[model samples]
Target: MKKTMFAVLAGMLAMGAAQAQTLSTNAADTAPHFYMGTGIGVVKDSVSGDRDRTWKIFGGYEFDQNWGLEAGYSHLGKTGFYVPGTTDYTAAHIKSSSVYAAAKYKYALSERTSVYGKLGLSHGEYRYSSSAPGWNFKESNNGVYAAVGVDAKLTERVSLYAEYERNGKRAWNGPENRIFGAGVKFGF
Candidate 1:
């Protein structure tokens, strides 16, 4: 009886140590050092006639558990509007594209979830076209951009996220472009 009890106690101690080592190794392996993702969503302009489709591709590097840097390119789709009560019917369309770099901050709510915010500088170009007067205009400008979102880890190397972002204003005093979207991120 003494021999049997001694053997069982030793086995339990060895098992506990092995479990601790595995947990530490898993923690190191699950940290996200780099990640990339692409998202497609609806873009709405305050002055435009309707909401349009928007898409973006982004990549980032996490320097630590709480902070990172990101860069992305986005296409804000075209919006069309018609002038009413006109002798000749005419429509105007506006389209835009942007590139931006931002700093990201994350607040972990649990082991699998976090909330984040971003602020950045954006450079974009807008094109306007009208059929009535045969007018076409193009303009480029730089502006400030911002976003807030949440992320939920789905696996060791993948996460799912949803965000609300303001890419930037089209011009100094022009309309702002906004987007709401969800996407998956792959980490390395």
Candidate 2:
């Protein structure tokens, strides 16, 4: 009876080990190693009467499930700035591109849905052009970037996310910007 019991216990242990291996494999498969995404949103200058249609394209590498490095280019489009108390106006085409190394903390709401917050240091160039004489500007800046978002998996390799992000202030007295947008990501 003792030998029989030992054999049964060993078999159960073997099965458990195999099951654990399978679970680990599944988790790794779902974890994103590399991803690329694009989003469209509106960007507004908080200190100026400038608002524009914005779009961004980004790609990143996940070191683990909760940490990643991301780089992106953002086109803030044309922003029309009206001189206060005057009918004179100027339009500036703005573009911001950044590279951020971010830490992401996430809480799983379900098997396929999660909420995450990202905090990072962003280094980028801010460029703007205006039709007004001598109004063109280009500068490089580093600042803090943060975002809170929710992600839902649509497939094993594709997911959709909606996020509100503060892209931080640019150097040289550039206006701060924010974006609320949705994006789709493909994982590899």
Candidate 3:
């Protein structure tokens, strides 16, 4: 009877330990590491269109089942002529750089794949270049962004992802800029 009781107690202890949860990106080889991405955007007005590209590089820390934190840098720029056959136009070659902190939620579709969404705030500077002589404009602002992404873990420490985000850049003219991008991530 004593031997049987000892065996039952051992089984209970093992079950208790098994029921305890363990979480960490490192625990799953099919976990995300880092990401880099960009977006193609078009800004339009009654007389002109400003087309440009925006990009970002970010890293995430997976603390548990459905939550993470992300931080990254992004930039968007555009330059060209507008209002064809007109000299009285502005050249809004605007470039912006910002750092953002975001909270993420993800759903796993498979051992190697997952889709996630994030929302965050960023502070950045805008450098606006104009075609008019001595007419450069510069300022800074705080903005918010929402993004969606999918990641494929290729290894225990590496993952690749494609993501898109809205970058709000309002030009002096009548055009506004947005951003999108895709890139790889590495985690420790």
Best by TM-score: 1
Q: Which is better, 2 or 3, measured by TM-score?
A: 2
Q: How much lDDT does each candidate structure score? A: 0.72, 0.63, 0.57
In model 3, the worst 10-residue window by lDDT is 38-47
Tens digits of per-residue lDDT for model 1 on 84-137?
Answer: 565676876767788899999998655556679999998888887886664478
- Comparing 1 with 2 on lDDT, the higher-scoring candidate is 1
Could you tell me the lDDT of residue 34 within candidate 2?
84
Q: Show the colliding residue pairs in model 2.
A: none
Per-residue CA lDDT of model 2 for 39-83, tens digit only, reads: 776656654646555677888877766667776766655433433
If scored against the real structure, what TM-score would every candidate get? Answer: 0.75, 0.68, 0.64
lDDT (Cα, tens digit) per residue for candidate 3, span 1-188: 33543453344334333432332344654354444333332223322454445556666677665788888776554444443344777554556666688898988655556678988887667676666765577777677867776665655456556555654444444324344445567766
Clashing pairs in 1: none
TM-score of 2: 0.68
Supply candidate 2's per-residue lDDT for 99.
58
Q: Is candidate 2 or candidate 3 better by lDDT?
A: 2
Identify the superior model by TM-score, candidate 1 or candidate 3: 1
